[model samples]
Target: MTGIPKTYQRIVLAARPRGPVAPENFRLETLDVPELADGEVLIRNHYLSLDPYMRGRMSSAKSYASSQPLDQTMIGGTAGQVVASRNDYYRVGEFVGGMLGWADMGVSDGVLLRKLDTTRIPLSTYLGVVGMPGMAAWYGFNQILEAGAGDTVVVSAAAGAVGSVVGQLARLRGCRVVGIAGGPEKCEYVVKQLGFHACVDYKAGNLEADLAAATPDGVDAIFENVGGACLDASLARTNAFARVALCGLIAGFNGQEMPIKNSRLLLLNRVTLRGFIITEHMEFWQQGLQELAVLVANHQIKYRETVAEGLAAAPQAFMGLLQGHNFGKQLVKLI
Candidate 1:
């Protein structure tokens, strides 16, 4: 990339969203794909991941992770083939996944962008199953909550990326699984496709009643994704010494504040809650990727993604993810 492009597609934060993100908050424009130096690689993005955590990145406030700069390209996970390389760690034609953001072209030093082994799975799979979400489920189950067979597991946002896999993995472990999603369709998919014993829809109302019916025996483990009312509902059914794997808070992604009733439920139940971003244990990334490959090869796991075509639709698709409008793992296809 001696002489890079004068303009490239990018999604920028025009303004901090007060509530739900609107089209006005994001402004898409063209910018230069910076020239790569020695030991750097230039990648033409073929796919970009849209996760719920991205919503918090738009704000300028201090968070668990650093916030994205205003009027700059939105931060996101992406997968693409390397087009230019100057490092031995990466070579041209190799696919990679990392924080490439929403851009048509990206230049990185391979520090953040890890070289992906495309031989094991599809390039897009790197963004879902074998990527961050996969690592998230592994960490949440194996390390954080430490789930096991005979445990009753409940997962919120169970049709989404990490939650979906967590629910299914619990089922494979012989644990009773209950999923909480948004609507009838997603709830049905969670039970039918992900192999959950039952699925509850928060949008259908009476969260307490639905959650009670779903896990009548009391929930022993919780793979938490959506917070707020859903969190409250889960707390109501938690058994003694319940382990809660705090994954994400997509419930607040819409910028709406959620109220948690009776904070004593955690203290009363002796619940052990562990919050994580999945990157905390980068050491387990390889382990997760390898294990997921075995599962995929053995036909023990299933996955899905909602791909949005074109770079221009990236912002809208991203917003759609925050609203639970996306059916599965959301991705933007560039080429």
Candidate 2:
């Protein structure tokens, strides 16, 4: 803590977006690092996670969670090292993960912080693969979908943090996995790199036909990330009693309407669709993180990230993510 800076830069939610998010929605502020009280810890964040779910947080519309208040630090997950501490449980230099918002430094009372062990996995991954995204994938796939051997599992936004893990886990369970992504490059990575049996490029303008071709046996389970046309196409090809883990609806994040044209299939096919918010299910996180950590450490799982440099870049990076420009988990390197 000897060379710690007296002040730090942080990005706050300057304004709420009306439609698609813009750079004007965020504002950077420089503030003095506060003096720690009896049981507080200071963290120097290394990475900031920019996720699709964050878009919902930026709106005033009613949802499962409260909207991010304006003129405050933009809400986000952070991975960092404890630079200073007056807390007995957390010592200086320990790696940690927390909801530290979009800032290079944050202070906590240790209640919301989780000490991390980077020995088996990288610290940055704690914000992606083995963190909230990984837990969401695990809970949704294992608990809801319950996909097993001989099943045909389809993952939309397969190149992203959550969907990527879902596809790989399904593959590990001896299921035939098909990925739906935005481009030929992402599709190739899903099959060639992530080991999915097939990948359908939704941007190819043949979503329905291509998805049908990919899942000739009919989709047994779907980890849906992008809703609209991708979900409609998959729903049209579902087998009877298929399960759908409705995750993010990123296609409609910008106020665009995303209606499922084949919604009638939900009744005809007797599909079981469940939408979940991972934060509501905290009890399963430890169990899920342990499994994900081992898989990541042993190279049994693969992940990719598109990182923007510094706090000021988070807004642009996040906007790009919503527009489907990012290839994988979008993040900001704060340090």
**Top model by lDDT, which number?**
2
lDDT of 1 by residue, 205-304 (tens): 8788989998888989989898888888898999999998888887777567787794798999999988988877888888888898788667788888
Q: For model 2, where is the 10-residue window of minimal lDDT?
A: 321-330
lDDT of 2 by residue, 45-97 (tens): 99999999899999999999999999999999999999999999999999999
Candidate 1 deviant stretches above 4 angstroms? 1-7
How many Å off is the CA of 32 in candidate 2? 0.6
Which whole-number lDDT from 0 to 100 does residue 98 have in model 1?
79
Mind sharing the TM-score for model 1? 0.94
RMSD of each: 1.9, 0.8
Question: For each candidate, what TM-score against the reference?
Answer: 0.94, 0.99
